[model samples]
Target: MSATVGSALAWWARTQPEQTAIVVDGESLDYQGYEAWSSRVAVHLRDAGIVPGDRVGLLAENSLPWSAMALGIIKAGAVLVPLNSRFKPAELRKVADDAGLARVIASDAVVAVAREAAGMGAPYEVTAFADVVGLRDAEPDPATDAFRVDREPTDPIAVLFTSGSTGRSKGVVLTNQSLLSIVFEASLTEEGFRQGSTSLLVLPLAFTPGLVWGVLMTTVLGGTIVIEKDLVPGRAVRLMEEHRVQAVFGVPLIFDAFSRTPEFAEADLSSLRTAIVGGAAVPVPLLEAYAAKGVTLRQIYGMTEAGGVATATLRHEAKDHPATCGYGSIFTELKIVDADGQEVGPDEEGEILIKGPGVTPGYWGDPETTAEVITADGWLRSGDIGRKDADGRIAFADRLKDLIITGGINVSPIEIERVLMGLDGVAEVSVIPAKDEKFGETPAAIITPSSPDLTAADVVAHCEQQLSDYKVPRYVVLREDPLPRLPSGKIAKPQIKQDYADVHVDFDKVR
Candidate 1:
């Protein structure tokens, strides 16, 4: 069987040609309709001298055209570089140049940013939506039975750039086999396709979890996908009711917003079966709340380098193990190893390492850095600390780089954040290490309150009851807005640390 993503997409198109494949806003496109448009886009790309293995940068928000363009690029056998639309002009330019892009497909909203990046004469051609989809009212190309080049399982499909704690972004190179492995694994475990299953695409497709698993997985399984440009709570509720969406994937923050919407309570969300929550730790209370609504909230834990998802709490286990990150997927092999590379026993916390078909080959153009993380034996050091229970369920601890060392004790920030998030009036919280002369470092809590009446002292007192004396925040900083987040919906901890470091305080005075 061919393992290429294009092959899977083609198979779905052939089997369900007239079935609805994508619905965006009010527009709908069936498999045949989408395939025809994708073919025309591929022909245009081929005519422009783009060849197999060439990188094509796609800069757009969640829209129908972006999905069409992605499929078109894959059919043309080119690597798709889905640049984050939130990136600034300079950041976009750096990614385009680094990937050695031959062409870029920019949406109307991002055309100006694309132009600014292309002005540097980076040897790449740029095309806006008007140039491709709106040019000359072109007719869709027929599905030609021409000779096509076969793709290996290892052929590069996409390059996802993820931010590092050291203030640099690393490009994780995903292949067709790796991406397909994740899609297949998710399908097998999640019961993704019943009869008329519909999935809502709320997260940005530029991110790995969204683009690779969220969108592409639905396509491969011949399921309908509802794409939304913005994640307004009202719009999400209306779309769910309008389309009878059965499954959805989102981060914790998105879930919170959806739950708080008045429309959510009134709308007919009974069609929703499974809601996969990840990107950040899911508060225990949030998990229980969603479960009360007849939606099974599965906690997924993975990173870009691992393709999409490594572990996910199964629907059956969602109610009991709401805090557990769950077991590894079918194709994924996860182990907790100590610093010396010895595998730790069950229930022991250690660095998480994964080895499987779902793991990416390595980072793009960074052999040294890649070698540092991906061992010679093919294990990718996840940089995350976790422990596996006897039942094979994995529970997340903290990122190795983000672990707080204070008073000769290593504290997992995730633990503190989870506890703090349960406090009354707290909307969001992030724990970081602050400079402390006595303990070398102390845990500091940066909190954003849902109400104006919340004060730093109130939060400190709340933590004093639950957390150990030392684990509680030595310093508290209240913010009016939520913390900065990455495109993946994970908190930008590096930026948070920097922001908190700028605050000068007397540790002795607080004590």
Candidate 2:
């Protein structure tokens, strides 16, 4: 057994076979159970001719099967490409084609969607692993006898999709050692990630926090993870209470939804000792609310290329600097750099550059784009705006990409602007982030109409032709003035964003 997840699982199964490894919808699978199930899946993959280094697709909603299927893919020594369950045919096709998947293992819940996506010209095969959890009954001679392919640490394990600044999804190639490095670091940390801890994960298992931090990190520590397929506010609260979850992870929106629930005040959340929140800045009120319950909700700032965690609010600074992402982790080195790439002094805002063991090697199959983001000397240009305080704590300023993260998903405004500009009467269009009660923030399009008659309906209709639904602006404002520009000739997004703050458009009234 090597220093991989598969080896870790084997160690755990041998040491504590009866320990509860995963729980979903009231059913629990012990370490031995999931190990045996994943073994059978590995054997099934081998029988189907999936060789080492081949990329296999794992498409399913968060569930016990998803966990097993992912482990099986790893054990088979094949690369895993975890597709987002919410993707439509076009997005699915894009990922499948990009990954050049050897096969896709979709659970029964989304087997039909997978089949439809496969038929839409994704070469290779799609296996409908009916009753994925029932794979344990495949009746292998013994769990110990299951075949395990030794994988090199340098071998690529997963290609997680990220919405790049260029609009298309960039498959971040993470090596086995890259992931293990972070997981191994978490195991030794005193940040509430410990053995026998029960973690509740509500976010999607496709990327960052969900897979690397939530599932993989938890498994490495031999902890039990509670997985919920979809996050219905009430159900999520009850699920956490029912499981007596020790640690919880999600974005700020997840916490906001829980706070909105009437039961939040009295939800018996005493079991929640450590609350990890990320994605967006934590509102002071939200932090106070959790603090009142004796739960210190720490904020983390990271990206897909940083192995899911870069800087996290240290335990001592958790309550004081509730807004800042925090000091850099021992495994990652963080710095603020000026436009010319020189290191900036304290409290000076500049691009955040990170370099460490957690930083990814590069993006999959695209050396040109990878070279642009990752410097030749091994530093990753985060494309995010931030600054460091005198105390060495990192605080987020803004995004260099001008990205709108609505509902915790990145929406490229440039993609939408291109579509809106394509329509008649649209001279110039700038998409800015607007505050939303549900999603925290959504896209708002400010247009300078060129033609005599240009309707908001026309703009939205044109956007519908190209962009995804979430990327479409919920509010459209037609302006007679030119869009503000900086001295550098770039669109002054801060001004547009500030002006749009007070003006809220009702989406329901929009045509």
Candidate 3:
């Protein structure tokens, strides 16, 4: 039988009618209750003249209503455009117009931003969650039973916009089957779900990792999800203790914050069986910190175009191999290809490419950009550089574009960042290429110190001992605060480059 998003929800509702499926803040919703609420939301959307193929925009934070709206949109056979809540009004307007949305459903916190975006003369209607649901309650849709399972597995479910290398954002199109393939594969793997398991949701749902891996995977596996308003380390620990959360998904930044919290030593985190960490390079020191707490930290590698997770460090191998991104998941096939697009041997670094059921068909409304990344033969060029060991474990190197070329020598920024992250005073670091007069480009380090006493000489001295001289940063810029971050939780390299472009100097001057 072909599986659809709506059918998956219906299956869970039948099997676990009374089981708690979602806990948003303090409110609980069992599978039966969730199904009913989703049906009502679907009825409301249809009444608002939303057709099966129509695009419905969701501008909200991570909440029960947000999840319900997503399910309802899919059940109604319409496409969901989840707007990034962090986007400014101008940015939001561009996305809404590009997606051709008919109506936007926004949360109370983000309603003003949505209103301003709507005021930009986009041909879309805006409504808040409170207003829509309140009206639905007063005159409950008798047409709630009108929902029909008309969508195919291949039907587009959601559109995710990602910032391009050139600064423009491209919309990635994800189909129901593509997302389900990931969930289904995860269920069949070693990290497969057990009934009644619980997962904590902290990542923003607008990001592919949060929407696909954090929420959809947990729900499909018959697991209960506990949603938090934001990822405050102290609050997250409390929620974990209160709900006995078994799985937690976070990025490196979240882990960094959690490691410093008193809860790292004081909280009872024995309920946590797996902690999936990704979005940036996971430092070995950070991995050891969590390992000491009896929590396994699995490094994952994924993107918006790949339905969230393409590779992850398996539970059994996580401790022994902290740096590896692990082997491919059940739904995908991974290949490391050289510059000529030919597959390379084991332990050889090259561009990581993926071909699988979880891969998206293409980007929305941009054939030129889509053709550049996805080939005609179906391989999705990840643009990330990596290598696979003899045992089939894949280790991440750096992004193809992020590689620093100094005196014609290529250096991986992630390689240097990982080493710097282990330094005594460094809290975070980003390495980028600085234009040079003689050499094409040279490496520059941007450091955020955990201790104020740390100096540029200290970072250079530490690197000189560990890395090659050419790979060592020529210039060091101290960041008094935490580095800027993209919505996906990774350090914003573009912003950092722009901020320090004028401070470039010779390595001898810093020495």
Candidate 4:
């Protein structure tokens, strides 16, 4: 068998038939069981007229079936489009139309939302997740090899939509070769990403970090993945102890929340060997919090364009340069460049560029936008400002895109400002990131209202109806004076950011 994703699962089933592959909410699925389950789903999809190169939409919370369904789509040689569960109807409709989905598999919890979203887009078939996963008696005939399609290494396996800084979502097309390359390389270099290791996965599978690092990489290593739909702090600690989880991948907020749990003091975290934090800068207190529990919190840095992980701080190097994102991964190369596209010397702040096999080819159906970010020679403009030390370690400085990462989810300030600008009472609005001790950063709206009666409360209420829960402004500021502007007639965000540099949100009252 080839080194494609579907082949890896088949290989594992044949090699370790009874080995546990996944544990979801106390339910376990062995290698053979998972392979058979996914194969069955592929058969059903082929029966429903799905073929190679077709795009399939998966809308569901994290669950055992969701994992199987993801692999099943790959087995059937179709592209999997994982939709965010937090998306409202309009958002979903946009994604549905953009991906030109042929069929959508939705869980019972979000089936109604899927219907409403699909109703607004081009007509497509919607199947309940239960109906597809429950095809135990409808096995495919062995003569046709269960209708499994063979995929080449370069065949697109999944199209992940990353929320752009410009408020438009871009679908990044990822190939089987790209995903498998990262999986194999990281297994050798990334500590705790080893065979038989158990990892606690709390991030939603829809996101890049969760799907790539938590699922694909773990599966390729024949490791066990413990999926948690929601992050109940106490339950997460208990689950880690119960599963003897060796690896935990999440953002700073997750570790911060875990430290505050009552079980933190007496929790048996002895099993934890690799705890990696990303999505935001890891606070020193958060690293010390995990350190006290006998776990080291290593930092990782990457984006959806880099296939989830481009650089990671290894165990041996974590203590020396605790703040850096460490050296590039096995197959990744990193460089910092100035505005003139010239490589800067060590310790110089510039835009980070990545070149590697795991790097995305380009955005789906948007060649012009793709050319803007990725150079012709294959280097990707990360849009993140950072500096590389003499030792080749990368330290994050700031974002050129001005994206706000709240609770591990990327929020575009432009997206929120567009929504707020729709309000009749709002004349001009500028959204900036508010410092939060709990969530790292949250959206804060600073507005110069047209009407004197336009209050912060009204702004929040208007946003509640348009944006997702995490995208809503946690801190609102109403100013009587006009916001500072630049010569180009754009909002002077740098000046505004400096003005509110000390502004912090009380998460207890807002959340």
Range of the 10 consecutive residues with the lowest summed lDDT in candidate 1: 140-149
By descending lDDT, how would the candidates be arranged? Answer: 4, 3, 1, 2
Query: Judged by lDDT against the true structure, how good is candidate 2?
Result: 0.79
Candidate 4: stretches off by over 4 Å: 136-147, 164-166, 403-511
Off by over 4 Å in 2: 131-133, 143-145, 163-166, 403-511
Q: Please, what is the TM-score per model?
A: 0.94, 0.79, 0.93, 0.79
Poorly placed runs, candidate 1 (over 4 Å):
135-137, 140-150, 163-166, 191-196, 505-509
Clashes of each: 0, 0, 0, 0
| Higher-TM-score candidate of 1 and 4 | 1
Residue 388's lDDT within candidate 3 is 94
lDDT of 2 by residue, 8-54 (tens): 88888889999999988878899888778888888888888999999
TM-score of 1: 0.94
Clashing pairs for predicted structure model 1, backbone only: none
Model 3 lDDT per residue over 406-465, tens place: 888889988888878878999889988888777777778888898989998899998998
Per-residue accuracy of model 1 over 280-385 as CA lDDT, tens digit each: 7777777777777777788888888887678789888887887787778777888999999998988999999988888889888889989999999999998889
In angstroms, give how far residue 156 of model 2 lies from its true place: 0.8
